[model samples]
Target: MMTGDAELSMFPADSRLFEDSFSAENTYRVSGQNITIHQYYCANLGVSASVWESALHLCQFFESLDLSGKRIIELGAGTGLVGIVAARLGAHVTITDLPLALAQIERNVACNTPLSGWPSGAPAVCPLSWGRDLHRFSSAWEFVLGADIVYTPETFPLLVDTLVHLCKDGAVVLLASPMRREHGAQDFYSRVLPEVFEVELVQRHPESNINIYKATLR
Candidate 1:
């Protein structure tokens, strides 16, 4: 129910689902199973509002890959969509966000729990913030996932550091982000990431202007 330039623009007003105050619920069918997510919008915390395009792309990326038995952790998980899908696909997943987003993530995780054929802890929910609280994890993770987490350039170092700390054993980090013309996020990812880890483009789509990158310690 929008009009004017919003309805005419090609960028998809769906991302704006996070920009205002509203509650959202959606069922995502992945790998023959459907996972439902609950999201609440807070004008003050826009990122937690709803699903983003990068998440859907990431879920598709996961569906095509082999993640069985992997100890996976998803950072910056908004509505826990990708992680929930991964869980349904049989990966041991822990979906995380900052403390403010935990309740929403926990709720979605509960909705998809005991992922059919998988064990009881198919998907767990947690609160994780970059740089300051890496100690909560006592072990290294095999796979790390992030969707649309590269917006702010100022936090690049902290985010990269967290990846480094989590994947000390050479685990791969999968990050999907839309190419932004402003904020220097693209530039930082190109320059800094290679200095610390080996980077590769897993997929790219000009239409959506999103790129999924797979990185590991060099």
Candidate 2:
């Protein structure tokens, strides 16, 4: 059974989630670049089809960084917004999600193709189930990104393992998530994550109840 906060995190309080069927093309201005994302809201496709507020907050946070030429990868990149923004800011970004979620991410990536400052055109869309296929990815990334991915308690171990694998070379890990108490976000950040990485709360948006954390291999 999903907790109230978990359900709320999965489905935003906005009325749009109740629509019979809908898709939205929302535009965002990040790092002086305008990015338009196409999002589909369907119960069948699960939470990966919609854009989360944590993603927007993370994109805003990215504006403060110099991402030029940095090798970055985003895990559970729903709608690929954060990765797209990073690519626009000159980062070579790879966006990954579950296999079922890749099509939506690919469409969003394609919609924003030829992102300025991206070395090899659009960001690469890949399937990455945490704790699996760890060998396929190298530990050479400069940054690892995730937005609103730490809600479920059952996935904590897998997610931590993936983070350890990716940040083996001291790559910085940035995660943005809502403070969903019932969903175990606090425990994950305070207890589980600290066991593996040295974590720091870099930014917090009170109005949105979102916190951005920066972690590095200890």
Candidate 3:
């Protein structure tokens, strides 16, 4: 329950879920896992529809892979859903997003898995901003993940830089995007990423119109 104007204004009508509407309690089932998360807008902090779907699609993709003992990091983790799924699937996942999304991410992290429920290799949340310093994070991760994180053309370079910096040598980077034209994000992957990563479309969810790419360090 919140009363502040900031919090009240955060929940926009366009994104609101009514209690009685079908799927009002938004949730997605991760493929190959016996887990379904009750996803929702970070009511205290806005989220776009693309981000929500992308997160679910990415989580399902990860669940379908062999990630028994991998080190994973997720960038722009809006609600930390993908990272949470990764953790449940046995990867050591670190979730990072802009500071504005941190509080909701932390709350979601707590709700999904409390301290006592911190499994052997559960996920953890941290602050990471694209185009900014990442010195706070430890050495590179074996796999970097993101979903619908490419919003503006201006942030494209920074996202690429962050991905390159976090990807360990020979490690893989997985990202999902609902193809936005003119954003130049797809171009960055086509022209720029090849210099540092061998990229390929590993999976695509046509139903959701989301494209998932797997990039390995070159």
**Which is the leading candidate under lDDT?**
2
How many backbone clashes can be found in candidate 1? 0
Ranking by TM-score: 2, 1, 3
lDDT of 2 at 61: 89
Off by over 4 Å in 2: 1-19, 115-120
lDDT by residue (tens digit), candidate 3, 93-181: 88887666677667666656734565545577787766465667765578888887765665566677777777755568898887766
lDDT by candidate, in order shown: 0.77, 0.84, 0.67
Question: Candidate 2 residues 1-218, lDDT tens each?
Answer: 43534433442334454456578898887667678888777654567777889998899888788898899999988889999989877798999987766888888878777624355456888987787768889999999999999878877887899999999987999999999999899999999999979999999999989999999989
lDDT of 1 by residue, 129-158 (tens): 677668886446788999888877766776
Compared to the true structure, candidate 1 yields what TM-score? 0.86
Q: TM-scores of all models?
A: 0.86, 0.88, 0.77
Question: In candidate 2, residue 199 scores what lDDT?
Answer: 94
- The residue pairs in collision within model 3 are none
Name the 10 consecutive residues with the lowest summed lDDT in model 3: 17-26
Task: Give the top-scoring candidate (TM-score).
Answer: 2
